[model samples]
Target: MKYFYYLLFALLLCGCQETKKEKISRLVNEWENKEILFPKNSFFTIFAKDTIAFDTVDCDYKVFTYIDSTGCTSCKLQLLKWKGVIAKFDSLTHNNTAFLFYFHPKSAKEIAYILKRDNFNYPVCIDDADSINKLNQFSDEMMFQTFLLDKENKVLAIGNPVHNPKIEKLYLKLAMGESYTDKPILSQTKISVDKEMINLGTFDWQKKQQVAFTIRNEGDQLLVINGVTTSCGCVSTEYNHEPVQKGKNLKIQVSYKADHAEHFDKTITIYCNVPSSPVKLRIKGDARK
Candidate 1:
């Protein structure tokens, strides 16, 4: 009887423990269609340069991103990359999308310098006390802190489009309306990589390691690579931007530099015109001192 009771307790514990996928599903259900509140009394600026007025146009959609005073500020902000994304979005949507950035800075001077250095002139809010995050109770993960909100400030989607190509596509589709299609019909190419995962084994932390992956075009259509993104600042990638002909292969060079001696697992995402628009590749290894 005692053994049966112990077994039942163990089974109950296993059932109570949620998997990563289940947790993500719960978070999505919680935030979906939820209205986001903005602090009306908060001040706005063009990156500390000048005071700016906040306006919500009736037909406009908003992309709100928040950065807390954790980790590398400049890396998390990526203001230069954001500048290009905003420019493209404005050009395509005819300035119908509003990008609202709220930062909880560890140092005001550092934030100011980053804005100036990146030449980011977009309007931003400095939530010194983290008022925005406090109200929203946003996810701790940086990737989930950004959201796409409709005219009514209700969340249409959650996730950073810049980091995830699928999220980017979803944002464009939601904002551009039903009839809008960005990719060409001939761009529906099929692609396959030589290896989806690579193990670098043990290496010195200070030493840089590089590896290449071969991507073959398996479809009749031309394979156009839109972009390649890395999960960490320490990891970088290089690849040809030109289209890949059918039955041809493109080499993607990935380099990793460890910030400290530790075990690391990082991902590289390839954004292309294939049915699976964003293909993910992972690299893992132990870094020794």
Candidate 2:
């Protein structure tokens, strides 16, 4: 009777497990039909032309770049190049493509100063809440982020066009009412970690400690981890979500605050495009106040 009960319990546990694909499917379906909100800006002015309203600007393509501080030299270059290339075509003249830049919410002061210093001749708007972030339907980490949207505000591609040929090609093709020739983007990841559990041993309750987990792209394709969720509020995380090429590694730093004197066990659930996503990481230690 004991043996039979054990077998039944094992079977029940196995049935409760979710496959890798099911998680990814769930993530995608959540935002598939969600409309991109072009939230109104706090202030907007054209560098050289008449001011325009957000809803009044009509175009088939909208390129959004988030800007704050001007520390990224490459970002400046990309912005310049984008302005030059986009200038050859104007939405006012029925070019069907519109490229606009925005301040990353509360960055208007810094961004405005930089634009003036650089003699930026492009349309820049102030969105104090980074409203454009909503367009990121499939990823997290919005720094240096850009999105290519269609007339109906559908996210067609998610990337920085600075010097990327693929993005430029995608833009030009779509502008001409054509489709891209490349394979569709997966927007998913196949990743594995070096360790599933981290043992912090013993620590003082008032002290804070951090442990690092090395995440690797073990598949033959790209690996993307968009978001991370913790089981407890006492734990926080920092990580890079850049596309992890095959064989490459990304590290996630988990910081735990020992506020209570007890044996602690915590889990960090990460969101990614993987076969077995929502990867759960474990951390444990004894804390003494």
Candidate 3:
């Protein structure tokens, strides 16, 4: 009787272990098939490749060269080109290793300097003639895919126009000889705002005009406005000192001083954390003596 009880307990523990393993396997499969969307107006794609069964696709590539403030150059180029590349694809055909390159530059001038300093000697300008010919054998629209390739020119991953960070994590997991499962989809925050275009009409010297607008934060996240700037110095704006809470409205006050007699058209750009789009205010009027 004692032997039978021990055997029963062991069987139960093995059954529980098998159940956990099956759940993990299912999650991994789901992650492998997950689809990610690109950020607004961004062009990139992200995906994972098994590395053993994929091949490289033909595409025009551009290399981004980085030069430091001290004139030291860091050359890292994309293996795939961007020609005839669309933002969508079913899968990659190559089994190549992909690497993520990170760089930090203070300004756009540094980015430009690096490109010019190198005289474009990097491989970002190359295309595989054989791959190009084979890719061209397919329809033009079919040439839009970009794949991450291994050192041997095998496709390890594929993406469209947007890069997927989850896919990158998967690659990292594979490199570390670890397994990863799909993450649960998180709820997205929503943002909504009221936009208006104001016509200040005309103003005389020493006169001021008031333009009123409301800002509401409808997203789950807090909205932060870093600053407000005007195209011309004559215009000034003010917002409520308190942040507009979710489902609450805040007022924006813009005042324009007609210090000079001239025909003026100006714009106020509101720099905010709202991801839907940036808020733009238009102010137009003529100053009379």
Q: Is candidate 2 or candidate 3 better by TM-score?
A: 2
- Against the true structure, what is each candidate's TM-score? 0.70, 0.43, 0.34
Residues 199-288 of candidate 3 have per-residue lDDT tens digits of 777667568888877777777866666456455445667886655567777677888776457676666666555543335677777878
lDDT of model 2 at position 179: 48
lDDT comparing candidate 1 with the true structure: 0.77
Alpha-carbon deviation at 186 in model 2, angstroms: 24
Off by over 4 Å in 3: 1-193
Residue lDDT tens for model 2, 1-289:
1222222221222123466334433433443334457655435665423366544356767765665433432233344456555764454336677776765533445455555545676666755566666544334423225556677776555444443434455556656666445433476556778999999998898899899999988788788765565655467788875878898999999998854577888878675667565577899999886
Considering lDDT, which of the candidate structures 1 and 2 is the better prediction for this target? 1
lDDT of each: 0.77, 0.59, 0.40
| Each model's Cα RMSD | 9.8, 14.6, 19.5
Higher-scoring candidate on lDDT, 1 or 3: 1
Best by TM-score: 1
